[model samples]
Target: MPDRSLNADTVPAAGPHDVPKAQQAVEERLIDTVLQSFADCEDPRLGQVMQALVRHLHAFVREVRLTEEEWDKAIEFLTEVGHITDDRRQEFILLSDVLGASMQTINVNNEACGDATEATVFGPFFVDDAPRIEQGGDISGGAVGQPCWVEGTVRDTEGSPVPNARIEVWEADEDGFYDLQYTDDRVSGRAHLFSDDEGGFRFWGLTPTPYPIPHDGPVGRMLAATGRSPMRASHLHFMVTAPQLRTLVTHIFVRGDELLESDTVFGVKDSLIKDFVQQPADAPTPDGRELGDRTWARARFDIVLAPA
Candidate 1:
């Protein structure tokens, strides 16, 4: 029922007189040669992974009927991606994000953690040792955007409070630029705070705005070439950690944002979506912050963490 001539294993060896093996056999042989070359790797897992990678990668090449010119261009594009990478910019991660590998890997590696917030791409903007602020403090750092109030609690899967949980947050400004995007100032749009005894934390931030991923480098060129938009839905990034609990690096997406279904990095999930309610000036602020004549957005995002 199957075509034997195209079989990778049983195809006749190439020779002048015998019926010529399928050209596909040449590709299969190349895969076999590379696999054999790595067969003696000291690390069993590494060897297996490499062999599988070779098989799948070769299969994709054959499936696409890739051309020599296209392969060379791909090599050049990857080289450009590497050359553009540096301390501040991560072109490779951007590439992975756009190609869906980042989210796929997250799904496979983090599936065991149940009822916990789903993990997503840790985009390149995360910084170490963000400034610590108190509950009810604002992380906007004067970045200039529509006002927003964010309140939430950290709880375990069983609905118990996770007190003193460390909550780290960051986001971009209304103009689609992060604090990292500014050379003169790299401190806005990020903060860390600890939850109270009741497992509650509150803060002030800006409403999430749709913004394009950093697309000025090779990643941007690739997006343009592939006819894909670089826009990510409005979201607030949160990384929550507590003793004996798993850390969650995730986003709280704006419920009605137009780009929710088409986040550039494929990070949106139904569980992560939340309604960002718009409030008038007379509405009572969660923390009683005085707003005499201002309208703002409010969103509540309670986090559930799994055990480590």
Candidate 2:
């Protein structure tokens, strides 16, 4: 009860010349009222968060003078986003990604430490229980794309080998579709493997290629309205995890990809871009697997993880 009532001096003078100021005082009172409701919240953190959220939301509404019609439209759009979200599709994540919210959260959480590999947005396509592959084995699993040899070592920031680290890798095919996008139960273009005793691992995957995110839903409409493209840069996804180390969800972009500068998710990092060297169709394969006449590519990505 510390003077919850507004002081006359704190409010604008009641006169014809103070219409805007009076309205602002009223709005501020509303914000205070909403904030007070959370005062008795048992959790201090929740109360603090709720109060901040209320303040910001009210400030936004006041700054924009948001119209009822616009608010209604936003509600409608979010409803559509919820309706379209299901097992295979996540329109909410797509919305967050396109707005750079995902990358912003990553940036806030991932601090620069030593030469540790930077983190990026984890696209919604990752699935649990992916097929496992042996070292130097093929993860493509018959996906349609040029073969790519992906080799890498997992090391700590001190450059110590992290043996038996779990690495999950996945990517879309040449046609710009993940295996889950197909109507059938086909599992390809994704797999997991553990680092060797020496922290080395290699596998065959499809060459990274640029692809538009899933964009036939409400999120797509939003993008179209804003004059933005949904294309992500050519890249491959990796999630590396080891004991007592920070788990990393990142991607390696192909150097010189046109979409790198404007990736829809804003997930590209200069440190993550690597060269994918193309080889002749008759070039020898790393594991000596015969690839009739199709050319292949190779890339090496050495990862350094930060302490947990």
Candidate 3:
């Protein structure tokens, strides 16, 4: 007890590796414990996924030396995301899109089959049972924007027309808002129609315009905090399906959009970028539906489906 108050000479000197080695061991042990807990998962795939997830998650936390406060903040952010999600709004998908996770998953699942239209992110705005339209009918459904004539032919990988293929199209309006984003029960800028016997279809829709992904929520906040823009390149969504053919979900991005290189969702593909030919106000409309003085646009997107 008389010598308990030790001087520097009496105290043990610490090596540079000593503290880190002990901390590393503790972190590894925790990771091992979490992995073991998932070992008994009934599904083999689930067990594999859970174990891998735990490993990576632990590694991330360790690499960053994540603080308790940071972890708590993350949980709080996710809670807000869940709270804001609903049938019409999907904050999680927005998060995944912005993080490039959505595009990565799409790239993994969608193999590059020769000449098949490349697939892209299935955005959060698609809704089932969209109003059907006849060939060359208007899909605008009273949504406001510049008129655009969209036409395309559905074909198989073998270069043959695929008739009766169902095409679902949806997009945001000039204001960068989907029909579902409004307060009322309104449906516009979305419709579904079947490819004709000749595998051809056309519809009047709005000219694809640059729009921000819903940026008034937690995802928006994250984008701001990270100094990232939420602007998506102008695009038109398409989901084409037919019997014995692989269903294709993709978008046609505006060819010259400045944001094409930095689309918030990473949804642009070189093959999917197409020219939207501009028309003079006096130019005749595709379906002879006249717009007194509005300058419209036209885009042709030929789709090639792979065998299912």
Give the TM-score of each candidate: 0.90, 0.93, 0.92
Candidate order, lDDT descending: 2, 3, 1
Tens-digit lDDT track for model 2 on 166-198? 999999999999998898989999999999988
Off by over 4 Å in 2: 1-19
Using lDDT as the yardstick, the better of models 1 and 2 is 2
Q: Model 3, stretches more than 4 Å misplaced?
A: 1-19
- lDDT of predicted model 2: 0.91
lDDT of 3 by residue, 170-195 (tens): 99999999999999989999999999
Instruction: Score residue 163 of candidate 1 by CA lDDT.
Output: 95
Candidate 2 structure, TM-score to reference:
0.93
251 in model 2: Cα distance from truth in Å? Answer: 0.3
For model 2, what is the error of residue 217's alpha carbon versus the real structure, in angstroms, after optimal superposition?
A: 0.7
Model 2 error, position 111 (Å) = 0.8
Give residue 88's error in model 2 in angstroms: 0.9
lDDT of 1 by residue, 214-299 (tens): 99988998889889999999898999999998888899999888998889899999999999999998898888889789889999
Choose the strongest candidate by lDDT: 2
